[model samples]
Target: MARPAVRRGAALGLGMLWWWAVLRLAFAPGAGVLEAAVAAGGWGLSVLPVHCVPRAQAAGAVGPERWRGAWRAVRTTTASPLRRSDAGSGPW
Candidate 1:
Protein backbone atom coordinates (compact mmCIF):
# COMPACT_ATOMS: atom_id res chain seq x y z
CA MET A 1 0.00 0.00 0.00
CA ALA A 2 0.98 3.61 -0.44
CA ARG A 3 1.09 4.07 3.31
CA PRO A 4 3.68 1.36 3.79
CA ALA A 5 5.72 2.72 0.91
CA VAL A 6 5.62 6.19 2.41
CA ARG A 7 6.70 4.86 5.78
CA ARG A 8 9.61 3.03 4.18
CA GLY A 9 10.64 6.14 2.31
CA ALA A 10 10.56 8.20 5.46
CA ALA A 11 12.60 5.61 7.36
CA LEU A 12 15.18 5.53 4.61
CA GLY A 13 15.37 9.31 4.53
CA LEU A 14 15.92 9.47 8.27
CA GLY A 15 18.54 6.77 8.07
CA MET A 16 20.43 8.64 5.41
CA LEU A 17 20.30 11.83 7.42
CA TRP A 18 21.63 10.01 10.47
CA TRP A 19 24.43 8.49 8.46
CA TRP A 20 25.43 11.86 7.05
CA ALA A 21 25.43 13.46 10.49
CA VAL A 22 27.56 10.67 11.93
CA LEU A 23 30.02 10.90 9.09
CA ARG A 24 30.26 14.66 9.45
CA LEU A 25 30.95 14.41 13.16
CA ALA A 26 33.41 11.58 12.74
CA PHE A 27 35.46 13.53 10.22
CA ALA A 28 35.22 16.95 11.80
CA PRO A 29 38.48 18.77 12.58
CA GLY A 30 40.19 17.66 15.79
CA ALA A 31 37.80 14.71 16.16
CA GLY A 32 39.64 11.63 17.38
CA VAL A 33 38.58 8.05 18.12
CA LEU A 34 37.20 8.96 21.51
CA GLU A 35 35.19 11.85 20.16
CA ALA A 36 33.69 9.78 17.38
CA ALA A 37 32.83 6.93 19.73
CA VAL A 38 31.23 9.30 22.22
CA ALA A 39 29.21 11.01 19.51
CA ALA A 40 27.96 7.71 18.15
CA GLY A 41 27.05 6.44 21.61
CA GLY A 42 25.21 9.62 22.44
CA TRP A 43 23.28 9.48 19.18
CA GLY A 44 22.30 5.87 19.85
CA LEU A 45 21.15 6.75 23.36
CA SER A 46 19.09 9.68 22.11
CA VAL A 47 17.30 7.50 19.56
CA LEU A 48 16.49 4.80 22.09
CA PRO A 49 13.43 6.60 23.42
CA VAL A 50 12.05 7.07 19.93
CA HIS A 51 12.24 3.34 19.28
CA CYS A 52 11.11 2.29 22.74
CA VAL A 53 8.04 4.50 22.88
CA PRO A 54 6.53 3.17 19.68
CA ARG A 55 7.14 -0.43 20.62
CA ALA A 56 5.63 0.06 24.04
CA GLN A 57 2.55 1.72 22.60
CA ALA A 58 2.14 -1.03 20.05
CA ALA A 59 2.12 -3.49 22.92
CA GLY A 60 -0.82 -1.62 24.51
CA ALA A 61 1.27 -0.12 27.28
CA VAL A 62 0.16 3.27 28.62
CA GLY A 63 1.51 6.14 30.66
CA PRO A 64 3.95 4.99 33.33
CA GLU A 65 3.78 1.44 32.01
CA ARG A 66 5.05 2.64 28.65
CA TRP A 67 7.98 4.45 30.18
CA ARG A 68 8.77 1.54 32.48
CA GLY A 69 8.88 -0.83 29.54
CA ALA A 70 11.13 1.54 27.68
CA TRP A 71 13.46 1.90 30.61
CA ARG A 72 13.58 -1.86 31.10
CA ALA A 73 14.42 -2.38 27.46
CA VAL A 74 17.16 0.21 27.59
CA ARG A 75 18.60 -1.15 30.82
CA THR A 76 18.71 -4.68 29.51
CA THR A 77 20.29 -3.66 26.22
CA THR A 78 22.97 -1.48 27.82
CA ALA A 79 23.66 -3.93 30.63
CA SER A 80 23.91 -7.02 28.42
CA PRO A 81 27.67 -6.87 28.10
CA LEU A 82 28.18 -6.35 31.80
CA ARG A 83 25.73 -9.15 32.63
CA ARG A 84 27.66 -11.70 30.60
CA SER A 85 29.11 -14.41 32.87
CA ASP A 86 31.82 -15.79 30.65
CA ALA A 87 35.17 -16.23 32.29
CA GLY A 88 38.12 -14.03 31.31
CA SER A 89 35.71 -11.71 29.57
CA GLY A 90 36.92 -8.21 30.28
CA PRO A 91 35.11 -5.00 29.38
CA TRP A 92 36.50 -5.47 25.91
Candidate 2:
Protein backbone atom coordinates (compact mmCIF):
# COMPACT_ATOMS: atom_id res chain seq x y z
CA MET A 1 0.00 0.00 0.00
CA ALA A 2 0.96 3.67 0.17
CA ARG A 3 2.37 3.14 3.65
CA PRO A 4 4.88 0.57 2.40
CA ALA A 5 5.89 2.84 -0.46
CA VAL A 6 6.46 5.74 1.92
CA ARG A 7 8.60 3.57 4.16
CA ARG A 8 10.69 2.40 1.22
CA GLY A 9 11.22 5.95 0.01
CA ALA A 10 12.27 7.11 3.45
CA ALA A 11 14.73 4.24 3.77
CA LEU A 12 16.27 4.97 0.37
CA GLY A 13 16.63 8.66 1.13
CA LEU A 14 18.22 7.98 4.50
CA GLY A 15 20.63 5.49 2.94
CA MET A 16 21.69 8.02 0.29
CA LEU A 17 22.21 10.67 2.96
CA TRP A 18 24.31 8.31 5.04
CA TRP A 19 26.44 7.39 2.06
CA TRP A 20 26.96 11.04 1.16
CA ALA A 21 28.03 11.95 4.68
CA VAL A 22 30.57 9.10 4.79
CA LEU A 23 31.98 9.93 1.36
CA ARG A 24 32.27 13.60 2.21
CA LEU A 25 34.16 12.88 5.42
CA ALA A 26 36.29 10.33 3.61
CA PHE A 27 37.49 13.05 1.25
CA ALA A 28 37.68 15.87 3.80
CA PRO A 29 41.01 17.16 5.14
CA GLY A 30 42.16 16.63 8.76
CA ALA A 31 39.97 13.51 8.61
CA GLY A 32 42.89 11.20 7.96
CA VAL A 33 43.41 8.70 10.75
CA LEU A 34 39.86 8.88 12.10
CA GLU A 35 38.17 8.55 8.72
CA ALA A 36 40.50 5.78 7.53
CA ALA A 37 39.94 3.87 10.75
CA VAL A 38 36.16 4.18 10.42
CA ALA A 39 36.30 2.86 6.85
CA ALA A 40 38.61 0.00 7.75
CA GLY A 41 36.51 -1.00 10.73
CA GLY A 42 33.38 -0.91 8.56
CA TRP A 43 34.93 -3.68 6.45
CA GLY A 44 33.60 -6.16 9.00
CA LEU A 45 30.06 -5.14 8.01
CA SER A 46 30.38 -7.49 5.04
CA VAL A 47 29.69 -11.10 5.94
CA LEU A 48 30.52 -12.54 2.52
CA PRO A 49 33.78 -14.00 3.80
CA VAL A 50 32.01 -15.79 6.63
CA HIS A 51 29.48 -17.24 4.21
CA CYS A 52 32.28 -18.43 1.91
CA VAL A 53 33.58 -20.87 4.47
CA PRO A 54 32.78 -24.45 3.52
CA ARG A 55 30.22 -26.37 5.54
CA ALA A 56 30.96 -29.64 7.32
CA GLN A 57 27.76 -31.35 8.61
CA ALA A 58 25.24 -28.56 7.89
CA ALA A 59 25.32 -24.96 6.70
CA GLY A 60 27.85 -22.51 8.16
CA ALA A 61 31.37 -23.52 9.20
CA VAL A 62 32.67 -23.89 12.75
CA GLY A 63 35.56 -21.64 11.81
CA PRO A 64 33.95 -18.58 13.41
CA GLU A 65 33.89 -20.28 16.83
CA ARG A 66 37.47 -21.42 16.46
CA TRP A 67 38.45 -17.93 15.39
CA ARG A 68 36.80 -16.51 18.52
CA GLY A 69 38.60 -19.00 20.76
CA ALA A 70 41.92 -18.14 19.14
CA TRP A 71 41.28 -14.46 19.76
CA ARG A 72 40.49 -15.12 23.43
CA ALA A 73 43.70 -17.11 23.83
CA VAL A 74 45.74 -14.33 22.23
CA ARG A 75 44.08 -11.72 24.47
CA THR A 76 44.75 -13.74 27.63
CA THR A 77 48.43 -14.06 26.76
CA THR A 78 48.93 -10.40 25.79
CA ALA A 79 46.74 -8.73 28.43
CA SER A 80 49.27 -8.94 31.31
CA PRO A 81 52.35 -10.43 29.71
CA LEU A 82 54.78 -7.68 30.80
CA ARG A 83 55.03 -6.93 34.55
CA ARG A 84 56.36 -3.71 36.08
CA SER A 85 59.18 -4.05 38.60
CA ASP A 86 58.53 -2.10 41.82
CA ALA A 87 61.93 -2.57 43.40
CA GLY A 88 62.62 1.16 43.88
CA SER A 89 59.90 2.85 41.89
CA GLY A 90 58.73 6.34 42.89
CA PRO A 91 55.05 6.92 43.72
CA TRP A 92 53.38 6.85 40.33
Candidate 3:
Protein backbone atom coordinates (compact mmCIF):
# COMPACT_ATOMS: atom_id res chain seq x y z
CA MET A 1 0.00 0.00 0.00
CA ALA A 2 2.29 2.71 1.30
CA ARG A 3 5.25 1.23 -0.55
CA PRO A 4 3.54 1.54 -3.92
CA ALA A 5 2.60 5.12 -3.19
CA VAL A 6 6.13 5.95 -2.20
CA ARG A 7 7.48 4.39 -5.35
CA ARG A 8 4.97 6.33 -7.47
CA GLY A 9 5.77 9.56 -5.71
CA ALA A 10 9.43 8.96 -6.28
CA ALA A 11 8.84 8.21 -9.93
CA LEU A 12 6.63 11.23 -10.60
CA GLY A 13 8.79 13.55 -8.57
CA LEU A 14 12.04 12.44 -10.16
CA GLY A 15 10.47 12.37 -13.60
CA MET A 16 9.48 16.01 -13.37
CA LEU A 17 12.84 16.88 -11.91
CA TRP A 18 14.58 15.21 -14.79
CA TRP A 19 12.29 16.80 -17.36
CA TRP A 20 12.81 20.25 -15.92
CA ALA A 21 16.53 19.86 -15.94
CA VAL A 22 16.74 18.39 -19.40
CA LEU A 23 14.06 20.48 -21.06
CA ARG A 24 13.10 23.55 -19.05
CA LEU A 25 16.48 24.48 -17.69
CA ALA A 26 19.82 24.54 -19.44
CA PHE A 27 20.81 21.00 -18.46
CA ALA A 28 22.70 21.00 -21.70
CA PRO A 29 23.07 24.39 -23.33
CA GLY A 30 23.49 22.93 -26.81
CA ALA A 31 23.26 19.23 -26.21
CA GLY A 32 21.11 17.02 -28.41
CA VAL A 33 19.00 13.93 -27.86
CA LEU A 34 21.86 11.64 -26.89
CA GLU A 35 23.16 13.87 -24.09
CA ALA A 36 19.70 14.60 -22.77
CA ALA A 37 18.97 10.88 -22.75
CA VAL A 38 22.20 10.11 -20.95
CA ALA A 39 21.57 12.77 -18.33
CA ALA A 40 18.04 11.48 -17.84
CA GLY A 41 19.42 8.00 -17.48
CA GLY A 42 21.94 9.10 -14.88
CA TRP A 43 19.26 10.93 -12.92
CA GLY A 44 17.01 7.87 -13.01
CA LEU A 45 19.78 5.49 -11.95
CA SER A 46 20.64 7.70 -9.03
CA VAL A 47 17.15 8.14 -7.62
CA LEU A 48 14.21 6.54 -9.42
CA PRO A 49 13.08 2.99 -8.59
CA VAL A 50 14.47 0.12 -10.65
CA HIS A 51 11.05 -0.63 -12.15
CA CYS A 52 10.63 2.88 -13.50
CA VAL A 53 13.59 2.51 -15.81
CA PRO A 54 14.17 0.67 -19.08
CA ARG A 55 16.49 -2.18 -20.13
CA ALA A 56 19.40 0.11 -21.03
CA GLN A 57 20.46 1.38 -17.60
CA ALA A 58 21.85 -0.31 -14.50
CA ALA A 59 20.24 -0.48 -11.04
CA GLY A 60 20.30 1.66 -7.87
CA ALA A 61 21.46 5.07 -6.81
CA VAL A 62 25.02 3.77 -6.59
CA GLY A 63 25.03 0.11 -7.58
CA PRO A 64 23.43 -3.29 -7.06
CA GLU A 65 24.89 -3.65 -3.56
CA ARG A 66 23.42 -0.34 -2.50
CA TRP A 67 20.04 -0.84 -4.19
CA ARG A 68 17.22 -2.37 -2.14
CA GLY A 69 16.24 -6.03 -2.26
CA ALA A 70 13.43 -5.27 -4.69
CA TRP A 71 16.06 -4.54 -7.29
CA ARG A 72 17.52 -8.01 -6.89
CA ALA A 73 14.07 -9.52 -7.26
CA VAL A 74 13.45 -7.66 -10.51
CA ARG A 75 16.89 -8.42 -11.88
CA THR A 76 16.48 -12.10 -11.19
CA THR A 77 12.99 -12.07 -12.66
CA THR A 78 14.04 -10.24 -15.81
CA ALA A 79 16.42 -13.11 -16.48
CA SER A 80 14.07 -15.95 -15.61
CA PRO A 81 11.12 -17.60 -17.34
CA LEU A 82 8.83 -15.56 -15.16
CA ARG A 83 10.37 -12.50 -16.76
CA ARG A 84 7.97 -9.90 -18.03
CA SER A 85 8.48 -7.90 -21.19
CA ASP A 86 7.30 -4.78 -19.45
CA ALA A 87 10.01 -3.21 -17.33
CA GLY A 88 7.38 -1.79 -14.97
CA SER A 89 6.33 -5.28 -13.90
CA GLY A 90 9.18 -5.45 -11.39
CA PRO A 91 8.50 -6.82 -7.92
CA TRP A 92 6.16 -4.80 -5.82
Candidate 2 per-residue lDDT over residues 14-90, each given as its tens digit: 55655655686767665565555555555545434654433665565566789889877774334645446855564
- Indicate the worst ten consecutive residues by lDDT in candidate 2: 45-54
Stronger candidate by TM-score (1 vs 2):
1
TM, every model:
0.36, 0.33, 0.32
Q: What are the per-residue Cα lDDT tens digits for candidate 1 across 21-80?
A: 577676777646665665576578667755454644576656787778988876434444
**Candidate 3 lDDT by residue in tens digits, 1-92:** 99999999998987776776576436447667765775678676878564666534746345545466656567433554655677666666
Candidate 2: deviation at residue 32, Å? 12
Ranking by TM-score: 1, 2, 3
Relative to the true structure, candidate 3 reaches a TM of: 0.32
Please report the candidate that would top TM-score against the real structure.
Answer: 1
Candidate 2 local accuracy as lDDT?
0.63
